[model samples]
Target: MQDRTLIFVLLLGLLVCGAVSLTVGSPLPAADLLLAAMGEGDPRHRLILLEIRLPRVLLAVLVGWALGLGGAALQALLRNPLAEPGLIGVSASAGLGAVIALYFGLAGVWALAPAASSLTGAGLATALLLTLTRRGDTLSVILSGIALSSLAVALTSLAMALAPNPYALSEMVLWLMGSLKDRSLHDAATAAPLIACGSLLILTAPRGLRALTLGEDTATTLGIRLPALYLRVVGGTAAMIGGAVTVAGSIGFVGLLVPHLLRPLTGHDPARLLLPSALGGALLVCAADLAVRLLPTPQELMVGVITALIGAPFFLLLLLRRHLREALP
Candidate 1:
């Protein structure tokens, strides 16, 4: 009951933040009644607020939710604090898949090309990592993911170099950097269902995650099927990550930061961590999205750049702290 209350409060706060972000820019009057007087403002302003800005806000929420949930699940499964899409190369692999589809003009012909290719790349990377980790230790899996990520990035670079049209290459580079500019309803619609499905599976399987935290032998004693649970979490995270990259072009660090940031609030219980992390992630991304818009610049900053700026130092700090803690005792 208390957790439910917390989740509701967090969600409400996120929504309020999103609402404020929505109203901050443009020619629309800030008054509720005035803004409610639809069809009264410049059509472009109205469309910008309603169609462009709203969808981007919503996308930030959904992407954050998926990334947070997936991160928590992966961390629980691997029994590591630093595990995330960025560390494991899932985002890079997904990017490679999306680039392949785009370079071949598959994305231009079929709206689903980017997503399908991303899923394929993610699944393949997951498979390769699993296969390479014969003993299935955390270290082995992490190393495999790193190797796969390097390979994927190399391939993506090759594709960019070979792109037939410079314009297409330019657009791909911009997209890879990540932004919310000119997003539309269709972009949200494509990724939402995939994220929703994956989230449902993770939320429903929290008991298994809790069992996992005590390690494999203990979880097996508790009647948890280790292989099945691993598949569900890993595969579900792949779906979530792949879908997100397909739409947003590899926005980084939300998955890496949200779970750790909210763990204290959830008492460090993975079962409790997942949902709160989702809400926290939504809040972070929406706030960041608002910042990008509010910043005075000739060109709007990439969302990924902002998140990396904040997250990279934090990541290094975490590693240093961990090293110090280990060295102490």
Candidate 2:
């Protein structure tokens, strides 16, 4: 199928999933509440639809879009199919930043503290990555990212270990697991600007990435300005991943899985994959969020957990299939 056709289909799927998300939740006939909310006639319906569901749906769409785009951009820039948005270590740092906020009881008093602090964390982590990767090689990025993740994870664990109270610890743990439930419009608003900036930064690098598939030296020979390309892609990834974790906690797999799924359809060209990957990611997260609401579980499952559950097995299958093909030859 043509890239435009595939993207059109994904957009339609996203719309269908979004409609189901807005209309499928509790008290049944949320479609009525949706209409009432739009009509502005019923305060209670307005509260439920406007306050509860709309923001969650928006954040789901935005976060998914950011992750998917960031993932494809990172993979293309690094010339590594295995690379993901979090490979820059911003997500871990952002989560740690949120934990620090909750530990200090700031989130209790201020609704935006976690988001603010997490964005700061993401910025700091990105700065650290740039400092370490001044030479702008892919290996340096991978290594710096590993070091940053380890340090952030260690600090997060220490904070949990030294939590002043069980409530703080529980909150930290739950937030780390990630979810889109109970998010507010303010959270959605906060994430949108940064996600936009990051996405725009990433979108600029696809031509470079396409050139890169020829090899870094060849790309450089083509006047791709390797250092500037790295700067743009990394900075953009940090912003998007940071923004995503701020609102959704730590949802995973949308970045890694969506691109791989869409790659073959896009003929595996980095430039060709971006739009479809972004659309597919949004559709995946929106549908997953809706599924969590509909499932007959004790509690609404964390969407992050749901993605991890699906993605880990998918990764294993990917490896096994690759291995089997090699063995067959």
- What is the lDDT of every predicted structure here? 0.80, 0.88
The worst-scoring run of ten residues by lDDT in candidate 2 lies at: 25-34
lDDT of 1: 0.80
In Å, residue 273's CA in model 2 sits off its true spot by 1.1
| Best lDDT among the predictions, by candidate number | 2
Model 2 quality (TM-score):
0.96
Shift in Å, residue 65, candidate 2: 0.9
What TM-score, computed on C-alpha atoms, does each candidate reach?
A: 0.86, 0.96
Candidate 2's C-alpha runs over 4 A off are 27-31
Q: Model 1: residues >4 Å from true position, as ranges? A: 31-46, 105-116, 123-144, 315-329
RMSD of each: 3.4, 1.5
lDDT tens digits, residue span 223-309, model 1: 987767766676677777777787788778888888887787788899899889888878877887888888998989988888778
Residue 65's lDDT within candidate 1 is 81
Reference-based TM-score, model 1: 0.86
- lDDT over C-alpha atoms for residue 256 of model 2: 91
Query: In candidate 1, which residue pairs clash?
Result: none
